[model samples]
Target: MKNILNNVVSLIVVMIVLLLIIPLSPFFLDVMIILNIAVSLIILLVSMNIKEALEFSIFPSLLLITTLYRIGINISSTRSILSNSGTAGQVIQSMGDFVLQGNVVVGVIIFLIIVLVQFLVITKGAERVAEVAARFTLDAMPGKQMAIDADLGSGLITEDEAKERRYKIQKEADFYGSMDGATKIVKGDATMSLIITAVNFLGGCVIGMVQGTMGFTEVLQVYSIATIGDGLVSQIPALLISTATGMIVTRAVAEDSLNIDVTRQFGAQPKAIMIAGGVLAILIAIPGMPKFQLAVIALTMMLGGWYLLRRMEEFSRVPEPAMAPGGGMSPTDIEQMQMEDEENFKDINSVYDLLSVEPIEMEFGYSLIPLVDEASGGRMIDRIVIFRRQYAQEMGLVIPSIRLRDSSSLNTNQYVIKIKGEEVAKGEILVDYYLALEPPNLEKEIDGIDTIEPAYGIPSKWITVDKKEMAEIYGYTVIDPLSVMLTHLSETVKKHAHELLNRPEVVRLVENMKRQAPELVEELIPQLISYGNFQKILTNLLKEGIPIKDMETIMETIVDSSMTVRDLDSITENIRVALKRTITRKFCEGNSMRVVTLDAELEKTIITSLTNGDHGVYLALSPEVMQGVITQMTEEVRKFQELGQVPIILTSQVVRVHFYRLVEQFFPDVFVLSFNEISNNIQIQAVGNIAV
Candidate 1:
């Protein structure tokens, strides 16, 4: 499991300890669950990434415990109460009974659903806000201001995909009451686990309370009430359901999100797992089951299946293609397989066209030739010039008709004139045509005006009386089709490159690598060596303190141009590297949620430049909301910084309170931005990046 998920689990275990031992009024329990539900609902107001139904575990248990505590010694009566009344007792008992059954589990499920789906991303003054929070979270650790640690995991998201993901997260935030990019600010893995455990624990307690009251507390009495075979037969469905559920959960655990509680991905969704448990509940409730038969079947199925499934899932059962219950394969996978084995070409005609000439000739961000004068530039904008008798005749005022390319407005019309191998644009004026058609002034003997016009149906040829030199017949010429297309493709690729460079995650990853990866520098040497010698591009990343393995991976990825996280899993040797223990210590000490107002003076800029002035209040979420907040925040802040504009932020102390723990735990030398109050101005300063 990831550390964030783990910590969340730990927090949940602690809360459940409270839930188990504390003897609050049923009202207090109601209130606690309600408040949590409300907060969770707030998340639903935004676009949420994970569903929260996994929380049902708490309710079932809570029901059992509550029922046991309430019924005490009345086994038969409690069972009678549960079976009748159609989910609500008469008016007198309705309120009380409903609180136990209707309110707790249902309310929590509704609320958690809200939290999981809501997104509400906020960004105005987020950097300065997150910074102060980070500092406070770090506490009074020495030299923390200079340490910096960054993970290049996000660089694994392709530029286009990152933009899309960012958009989704941001739109979710927009649905909420804030507008900062909080997706990366507060780690969410821990928060999600917390929600799950809280919900599940409450659910389990409820289930235990309700069932135990119906003689479940004296389960031995139930077998005595009926035959062993009859009791065992009653729970066959529960047996299948529990086994299937356990099988699914066991399959889904993994070890990433380092320090978070998220299990690496197994195949099952949380809902599917919970439903599996629900199936068990429904199965156990089936009527007329014999005790011994039900027990034997359920026990056999649950124990044997659990063991087999656990081994299959946790140890060796690899992810197979997704399938339907009674099918050979799913539609998506079948389509994918078909595509993978597809023929290379449907028809082969032009072999040269098949080569990737466009990508080769015009790689993204690669430069096209520079031009001093656009008129003289090598752009072959071809023009067609048709010369007929009417235009020449009109120019000369001598013949009945001669046509020319520009008899009306030659001043603005340009032409593709081939000058050597390069193409140039030049005008063909009416004056040139005029000279060609000038009437023969043989009686007067003038320049070209002395030439004779050919007779009708005669070839206008062989006017060779000029002594020194005759004017060259010039118009326009065609340019190569392939080269023109290449130039156009190059321009488009460069445009896309600029957009990619500006991406928030890409900016931070590259900057971090530039600062911290020396070995990475050596790896990239191969890419540039063929460029023969190159100018060194010094960047902020050279400061260093990053782990050698991580640095190597970053360098290798950058050099190889990797585009996805799955690619990282395949290529990086140091997969699943543990996060430093220091993060655990630091983060544990700070407040969970940190809030700050935007700088009063530049509030407009904070709003306008970052979020179009639509954002007003800024609330940074709980550090427990996620595990990798610091690294993500660094990337976002770097994106803003790359814009060459500094964002207004809250004071430094608050930043430390929220994110310092992460800094000390994860970074080698973390770079920090500190905001302070100075007269009526917010003064921001760098707390030189620190090494974690």
Candidate 2:
């Protein structure tokens, strides 16, 4: 029964089209005319009440269908009028007599005015709006798709939600595109109505005089009234539909309907209303004004303004309920007292919430809010998501979701990056400007605000967007604020990647490995070494910027050596030797590896200072010698950096860990590798040496 009922409208539309050829009686024609008016009114009301355009996505199709119906009605009425000389329907006769009032010229003029208004003003405006809307909606699709993907990648929204959002974007584009073409159909319908009305007047006059035995003047009078009435009946509905189309295309998405929004906005300012009332009163008091009519309108406006002000005052005077002394309260305060009672209820495990911290966080100033807001066309969050995926593939570590939020207390242009609840890096950027890095060996000076680049602290300047081309022409590296922030965030995450690894992450990594090599994981864990020791070995490698993507090699090496190696550092060294190829490839350039080697005497001294006990290996170097080693290492590292190479210190296996510990405090960015970790296939080049 429900399915049949749903198909009834389709059947009626088919019949409406068929009516273009079929003849209709006077009563049936009247009923169809009334039905057309009712449908048009309903459509207008629905268009006005909808909160969003999508809620009435089917409106374009309905517009086409209704236009067809109106044309079909015109055809049916034209057939009846020409054959019967204005005796088609009492409704048409009554309409013609009432509107024309025995004046054919006035009736025709009024009908032409209605047609001109719809075609020239309403239809043309709607068509242009629909065209522009379709173009913009289609253009915005890619950005909207990226936003959905970003939300899904960041875990801010579920997969289903992302799919739904994407579908909605596509639907919106389709709706506007259809409306663009559908508006043309409406314009064509208006043109056709004009032609049909003219045909009815001229054709009816010829038939009335030639066949109906009526004089020429009488024929003109009768046909003009009938033609104008017919045009009125059709064009009035067309005007309504056109207006509805305009409203649909121009409506902005809001929380309320059009009527409510207009009322709220217009009534928001009582002072404006009062001023308008005052101006009206002044005009009424002047001479030659309609005093009574102006006075009534002025009085109404003043009264409305006064009422609004009084209501606002009443709202302001409503006081918040305060707690009574000794927990005593009146009956009027029972609701507030009950709310307080609910607030006192606490869960037993609520304390666990305090123990959790985000692995990575970025707090941006209020000025940068648009960088993360998808609606504002900001792609920073999307770029961050892409960076996270790429960083994971390069570093072989699953970075946790970085929580982004706005900070009100920070400077408007500043942003802070944190890891494990501690601020690690912060920088300032101009939201509307671009950062242009100084080109290599360039002597030309550019006009801009001189500031250092936040990512790498290179010499850079903040330049206006219009100067971007000029900077690029000079071979300067231009980057947007979002890219600058992401670069800083990427480097900071890499530097602190070791800190992000914990027991849960370690377990997740092991579980991932078990899928590929179950026997290796089983043999390396519980039997030879504990999970905590293995995690520590991984952490130690990561601390020096090593990737553990070669899980098979690491697991096999650990399984082979864990039976004899009890110290975590010893196990780590053994694993590094097994991963010599990976480590060498990471730090070496092509077939040769450039390194800063320690002097033989200093190496021997470091080996002697290393003492092994129950706690682990410890470097017991004197303060004087440690200071000297740090000073020399800093100089060597600086030289490597100047040559555009990462600083890598190579030493023998026995003293490698101790040397790393000694230099790590002073040069945290340096890579410390043991001789055993260097692959024999790669050639070694000692670029510089550190002597103490």
lDDT of 1 by residue, 1-692 (tens): 68878698457545545654444443443344333334334433221222321222232232233223222212222232233311111221333233224344443354344333321212212223434433433342221111110011213345466455555443332322121123122223224333433433343345445655544433322222221111111122122222222221221132322123233232224344444544554566678756566555656555554554565567665777788677778888888877765643434544546562111121111112121112455231111001112212222111111111212222332222222222222222111132232222212222333322211111112223341134222221111222333333323322222222223433343455577765666556544321111111111111111122243443554455433432222222211112122212222223221222223332332223322124332334344533444545566455534443322223243332123333434542233322321222222243222111
Residue ranges of candidate 1 with Cα displaced over 4 Å: 1-10, 13-28, 45-484, 487-692
lDDT of 1: 0.31
lDDT tens string, model 2, 27-122?
999999999999999999999999888999999999989999999999999999998886668767878888899988888888888899999999
**Highest lDDT model number:** 2
Off by over 4 Å in 2: 1-13, 25-27, 84-88, 136-159, 210-212, 286-291, 320-423, 426-436, 443-452, 460-474, 479-486, 501-612, 616-666, 671-692
